[model samples]
Target: MVHKFAIEQGALIEQLPEFIQSHFNMVIDVKADGPCGYHVVAHSLGRGEELEFYSKEYTFSNIHQTLGSIYPTPSEPVGTKHWMSMPSMVEAIANAFESPVFFFSPNLFSIMLPSLLSAQSNSRNIYCISTKYTPFCVLNDEPYEFPAPRYLKNWEKSATKEALGWAQLYSPNFQKAHD
Candidate 1:
């Protein structure tokens, strides 16, 4: 029902590429405040027709409990409520696609901003997003605080050129892009 509505509204369709025709994967990640874990949906692209959408939902708390109970010695590391379960969820959905497809997650991207920005140590993605004017210091599920200035300085030194390129797109000069 929701998927149909999304299609009607063009929210999900707008994100899809031309090769994709009809199908798409919808993944839903359950929020920590909710009963379910996050979900990820992937769609498969067909040769001439639209893509086929496959949807999957997974619960982190349930998996964590299962893993903990089965393997008492080696439990998965903890993660933010929403982002922690994302990788596996997305992987499973991708396998179902059977063909390459565009992945769409509007809210998910924003929620994972902190981790995405900080994915690589001393990398540029984080540095680019953590600039003086438009810094990202908040995790969606956690509190937001400004890290020490020294920490930022060290980050700038280690960030990669590629990260810098992306950062420039979001800088003040790219006001049109920002809009």
Candidate 2:
């Protein structure tokens, strides 16, 4: 369902950057009900299972085993603070696919600061994206709220460069260790 706020409020989308606007055309509608995050990740990894089945099979069934297997060392633990219980799920997905998980969030540096900071520093292939207009959630059934950065709205300034700088600094280090 499209977020109600996005449809009712034209100003939000109208003020977004051109690049973000262009990307909007390709939006894929995922089922909002149930574990949408898991569904999206599973879909991305080519896992055709539904949310419930995937959660039960991959997450609940063997989360501790998965975590122990990946992060056997005590120095580097596996889990997320803000996203409690999600670290295990993430670890399971990453281990299952043998690929890194990249989480893109507009508020990664802000709202997700605790989780980001407390995340396993040595978790390989887990890239984080902090940028403007990051889709957060569906507000009442209009479209996903793609709120422009506050700096953009107030000063007509784009934080893309700063965001990219942060990503560049962190991503390379994360990838280097893994590679």
Candidate 3:
């Protein structure tokens, strides 16, 4: 069976694509904390949102790797939380979990954010999530139960390399992490 990557709703809800908005009525909402994205990741992983410092470190490194030319690539401080998000955070979550993430954002499909799916690195592998044309909010189980508003049931399939294949199928730039 095919598994999905579910995001906790805040700003992402408004952005769901036609494919998802028509099929599923579920929408999970993580706490409105600084690390809500992390919360979504943690929830999917069957753990709490509190993670290691490497998560922050990994996120920043990817940002530099991907966008260093366009933005100031200094090692200066960056925040842990997000208003909506900063790029490569998805990549960070993918690395931290050792799982493949899937994006539900329409931006990638529309080319609003072209490199939105790029792994942001051409050198070493970055095991970030994949991109979907439609929208955000999804994942699987040891019978992992999603949070309120949906309480969706899924399995822990996203953690495997197989899930990575699924992500790659939908994600255009997934090769950056592999190739």
Listed per model in order, the count of residue pairs whose N, CA or C atoms clash below 3 Å is: 24, 7, 16
TM-score of each: 0.22, 0.31, 0.36
> Least accurate stretch of 10 residues (summed lDDT) in model 3?
143-152
Please give, for residues 1-179, the per-residue lDDT of candidate 3 as tens digits. 12233544323444644433333334444443343454455555545444453355355656434332322214432344323263345544555545444444445321111122332222121111223322123433221111111101232232344433333332434232233
- Choose the strongest candidate by lDDT: 3
All candidates in order of lDDT, best leading: 3, 2, 1
Candidate 2 per-residue lDDT, tens place, 36-144, comes to 3444454444443243445465545565553334332444433333222332354344445433444434322211111222233333332222224323221121121
Q: Write the per-residue lDDT of candidate 1 for residues 43-106, one digit (tens) a residue.
A: 1121111112211133344555543333212334233443323323432322232211112232
> For each candidate, C-alpha RMSD in Å?
15.1, 14.3, 13.7
Clashing pairs in 2: 2-141, 2-142, 2-143, 3-142, 3-143, 4-141, 4-142
The positional error of residue 50 in candidate 2, measured at the CA in angstroms, is 3.3
lDDT of each: 0.24, 0.34, 0.35
**TM-score computed on alpha carbons, candidate 3:** 0.36
Ranking by TM-score: 3, 2, 1
| lDDT for position 69 in model 2 | 45
